[model samples]
Target: MRTEMFVDGKWIGATGGTFASVDPATGEVLAELPEATEAEVNAAVDAAARAFESAEWAGMLPAARAHVLLKAADLLAARTAEFAQLETRDQGQPLAISAGFSVPNAVEHFRYYAGWVTKITGITAPLSVPNVDYRTRREPLGVCALITPWNFPLMILVWKLAPALATGNTVVIKPAEQTPLTTLLLAEVLAEAGVPAGVVNIVTGGPEVGKALVRHPKVAKISFTGSTAVGREIASEAGRALKKVSLELGGKAPSIIDADADLDEAIEGNLMSGLLNSGQVCAAATRFYVDRKRADEFASKVAAIAGSMKLGSGLDETSQLGPLVSLEQLEQVDRYVQIGRSEGADLLTGGSRADGDLANGFFYRPTVFGNVTQNMRIAREEIFGPVLAVLPYDDADDLASRANDTDYGLAAYIWSRDIGTANRLAHQVKAGTVWINMPPLLDAGAAWGGMKASGMGREMGWAAIEDFTEVKSIWTSLA
Candidate 1:
């Protein structure tokens, strides 16, 4: 495995030194990775700025840039298994999920955005006056700095990279310290695919590197994905720099099952939506709102699924759930499960740490808490684990009010056969994305973001292309 920073078209060792990258499953040190310094961060920004000004890159045709991205996508598709193994080993995501979802989704993001490169344009306006002409041009925003979280490291990095590159902007990305392997590998792939040197740079380090990157005078835009606490700091620094910033922060998404919903489908959706990726997803459904009439049934069925889910090393094919990203995260989940019990919520199933063969790993069982109130910490906080809290509501109004009670508004789900009820709930819930009769799903063509304190701005689709580009209007006399 490569264990150096990529900058200015070459692999270089970090002056700030290196840190051990531990495998969450085995608690074994996988590699010693470079710890980037503020000096290195500045160098990356300078390189990107220089690249953005270079004739070879800045003057390249939009179609040519798109071709590079498509080629990169093809290269990644050819080695999906290699990338998947790295992800499962480093991040503790199940091998099947790493191969099936993370790697494929990363490939799809590049391919999807490739088609938009030439299509990114501004429109011409018709002027009423005879001698007046008006038109708009969309242009890249120079160098962009991207900070991606560890939960979905490879996929999230591509989410930011694909759009930035498609819009013709050079980038300096800092991957999360916990999971930088796949991202470093991606830089190699981009290089092989003919991405111009300095066009894409990777700096691996802790928060100091991220802070330096965001505060660098040369970076024109900042797109971040992580906790709201960190996002707030990023926004503050960006605001001080007068830089454009887009954030996709944390979420405590509520999944509601109405009276007329299909019980089996709801149970299945609840398990996957709340428990997928070991519930490390930012938009994972952590809070469950069910009809009072079906509350007990919903709790019992979900509990059964939670109790039976296989917990082992991500490399094991029979394992459905893997360990948390780290021991710290695993401990955090355990504390929250205890908090739920202390708050008078019923522990339906699976709250303790895994034992026997799984004890060596950072594994926690899929946990379910019944008799939960809207105000409970487990119901309100972003657990970031395979823990589900079930709360009952009497009517539509009650369900809507309870669902909208949290500070988070990233994603929400509505499960009802009745179209009218589902439509109304979809409108009432204060999340950026709302799904009806389905688990939360994301398409590259649709915009994804959050509402309220969850985050500001959007990612994916044409919206992201617009996010990376700035619009300028031109007026002329045509007499």
Candidate 2:
């Protein structure tokens, strides 16, 4: 079978060159994907532009669009096992995470957005002219460029595609070079759902393809999810083109545990948000701040839980924490442990890679550092691993200030049973979303994005559809 780029209802090799998709876990070849050239990206954008301009999708009723999306969601749900297995093998995410979490949530996103397709409406203007009436319209942008990350490929793709398609825009998505197969699989399901040709296409490659999509004149909007470094570049280039863009970038989220919080529930949120998907998650709670008096207990509890998780192949049901997405990622996580030690943070437990039967893959011990200060490297920068650094603070004001110190404002977590205090803290935290008493739980219709460099604009919800669309006012005066 061809493991090439998907363009305009067909799969083919790259015009310029080819690249290999390596299984980051075993360091083996998964498939040979096309290294799409600038010309190829331009071509895909052109196809999308043509489809959009011709209104191949434009004239379709919103209910019709919703029907197709719902059908695709159903198809994906039925093929859940297949996509889950592929996601596990390629990205090294736990099979349970892929199968039980990301995959199911992906389907949910599609189904949710599908319902919104017909529900999105524009209001009639209250006319000042006696005989003249005015109206507003929400129109889909002509074409969009979607760029996804390796960490939650299926979920992120759905986040991009659902709103774009629901709003009646065509798209040319560039899947991350590391994990492209599941996206290709999605293309198959989209076609089976009766989406029109050229309405949605995907190209696989590295920087060149992404560059092409961002700069292509035919593309109207670009929605990207990746590291902040790359996101900055996309925003810069897209700015030059004067195109619409939405980015969901990097995050170094914090989970603050106060004196009055439920210790058990807070620990559960910390682990789930930090260690799920091997800490490859963007909003993973990497930094933990606790009350000074309870700091020791919190640190010990977290360490115990981190040490107890099973590490093995994602396919193994017993495995809770899977391999890091790549060897480089594993090394990066380990390096942070070293950094934490060097920076004078107390190494309570788990400061090395997991040994024994799990040593074959890129597995690292889920490390924890106590007495971590805000200035410490691990607490400030995004480690993007299963390592959690615990810091202690005396008061709410200090904790709030420390939490908002970083440039990232993607998401933050606060744990306390005091709803009033939690609400006040949530208001002060510099983030797009703050979850109190919980972590990383996204409602299907909730708006998701970041402040500062974490990213611009937002995704999910009917409000997010506004990002993929354009608003125009129409007036007719009998003057």
Candidate 3:
């Protein structure tokens, strides 16, 4: 693995101290990596700014830029297995998920954005003024600072990186400290794919490094995916500087099961969407609202499925669920589980940490709580773990209100056999993305973000292009 930080197309040792990258599955040190200092962060931003203005990058043809992204995508596809293994080792997600979902998704983002490179165009508008020409040019925002979380490091990084680069913006990335291995490796792939020097840089550190990058004057934009609290801080700093910012933050997404919904399908959808990656996803279906008459059955079925999940190391092929990202995360999940009990929600199954062979790792059993109320902490706050809180609702008339009660509005799932009812409820929900009769499915071609406190901007599809670029209106007098 590459241990040093990538800056200006070169591997440099950090001025800041080194930190150990621990394997959450075995509590073993995978690598001791360098943490970039404030000085180093400035260097990265300076490099990115220079690259953004350089002829080798900024002046290159759009087709050439697309070629670089496509080549990078091809290289990533070739090394998918290697990347998947490193992701599983570094991030503690199941190997199957790393291989099947995250790595593949990263490749697709590059390819998808590559296709957009040549297609990005300016618009000529007809104005009422005579002897004048009016047009709007979509231009890159220069250097972008991408601060990604540990849960889906590679995928989310590309969610920001692909579009930024597609629009001709150079970037400096700060991968979550806990899982920087795969991102460091990607620097090599981009270099091999002929990305110009200084166009992409990476610094590995915690919040201090992130704060420095966000506050850097040369950094024209900031794209962040993490907690809502941190997002607020970044937004505040960026607002003061007038820097463009897009955040994909925390979520407490709710899944609703209508009275006429298919019970078995709803149960399966909840298990897959809510408990995937042990529910560490920002858009995981943490809250479930079911018809009161069938609530008991839905909760029971969910508990039974969650109880059967195999918790072990990500490298273990037979393992169905992996450990939480770290010990701190494990404790946080446990605290919420305790809060659920205190709030009088019924703990249906798997409420404690896994023991035996998985005892040393940060493994929490998939937990489910029934009879959860909207006011309860477990139902409202983002647990960000494999803890599900199922709430029973009496009236369909007010179901939309009950579901939209949370501060988060990132993503929601609705299950109903009647397409009309599902469509109606989908329109009523406040979430940015609503899935009907399905689990959480994300596409590179579709926009993804939140409606309220969940976040301020979208991350995928054409929406990403808008986030990474700025419009410049050019008016010419012909008379």
Candidate 4:
């Protein structure tokens, strides 16, 4: 295992010694990762800065850069199974999910952004002054710092890196301490694909390392995906430094089930949407707003479906739900379940950790709560686990009001047979992305992000490329 910092084209051991990477599924010590110190982080940022100024990286043609990204995608596809196993072992996601969704999506991001390499455009404008000519172009921001969360480490990392590199920006990545293994492995993928040394650097450590990256004077932009609290901190630091940034942060996303909605489809969607990845997903539908007429029915069905989900090792295909990413995450979910009960929300099912064969893992069975109110802590907070809060609404106006009540606006879902109602509600809902009769559908070409306290800026698509580039206008006398 590569348990060292990848800086300046080479892997070096951390000066701060090593830290253990435990398998969330079995609580076994999987590997010892080097705890990169502040010095190593600085080295990474400096390396990226140097690479951004180098001809080999910064001056590479767009088509040539695309070739490198495309090669990386091919290499990733070839090793999908190997990387998927590593992801499951480190991130506690099901092997099938890691292979089918996470790994492949990482590859897709690279390929999709690869197409954009030669397509990044410039604009020619008609100048107000007859004697003057003006043209606008986008240029790379050197030395971007990417901070990714543990839940979807590889995929989200690629989400930021693809566009940053495609736009010609060098980067320093700080993967979450819990799941830095696969990201460390990505260095090998990039190397074999012929990405120049210092173009992509990775530093693995705790929050101190992240803080250093965000505040580094050499870093030109910050792209972070994690909690709102942490995102805010990074944004504040970036603001002080006058650096560009993109944040994909927390979500208390709500799913609405109208009276005319497909109950079975909503139930199934909830299983995949709310409880998928053990509800560690930032965009997972944690808040449910069902029409009063079908609230009890919806709540009961959710409880039953959540209860039936099998919990075990991610490597086991039979296991529908894997363990929480860590013991700390497991405890957090348990605490929220208790808070839901204490706050008078009906605990329809599951409020404890799994036992027996699954006891060794950080596994918690899916939990569902009914009669949830907007005011309750369980409803208001981002639990980041497989706990659902189901609330009822009597009217359309009330449903809209309640759904838009929270400070978060990352994503929202609506299920209804009435296309008119769904369309209108989708427009009214306060979120970056809205899904109608769907389950959190995401694409590399579509922008993904949040509003309000959720986060700032966007990721994915051509919009993501815009964040990493600075627009410059050239003016000259033509007469």
lDDT of each: 0.91, 0.87, 0.92, 0.91
Candidate 4 structure, TM-score to reference: 0.99
The weakest ten consecutive residues by lDDT in model 3 span: 51-60
* Clashing pairs for predicted structure model 4, backbone only: none
Candidate 2 lDDT over 252-308, as tens digits, reads 998989889898899988999988887888898989889999889999999998888
RMSD of each: 1.0, 1.4, 0.8, 0.9
lDDT of 3 by residue, 1-479 (tens): 88899999999996769998989988889999887898899888888888888857767899999999999999999999999999999999998999999999999999999999999888998999999999998989899999999999999999999998999889999999999999999999999999999999999988999999998889889999999999999999999999999988899988989999999998998889998998999889988999999999999999998999889999999999999999999999999999999989999998899889888889999999999998999999999999999999988998899889988999999999899999999999999999999988888999999978888989889999999999999999999
What TM-score does structure 2 among the candidates reach?
A: 0.97
Tell me how candidate 4 scores on lDDT. 0.91
**Total backbone collisions, model 2:** 0
lDDT of 2: 0.87
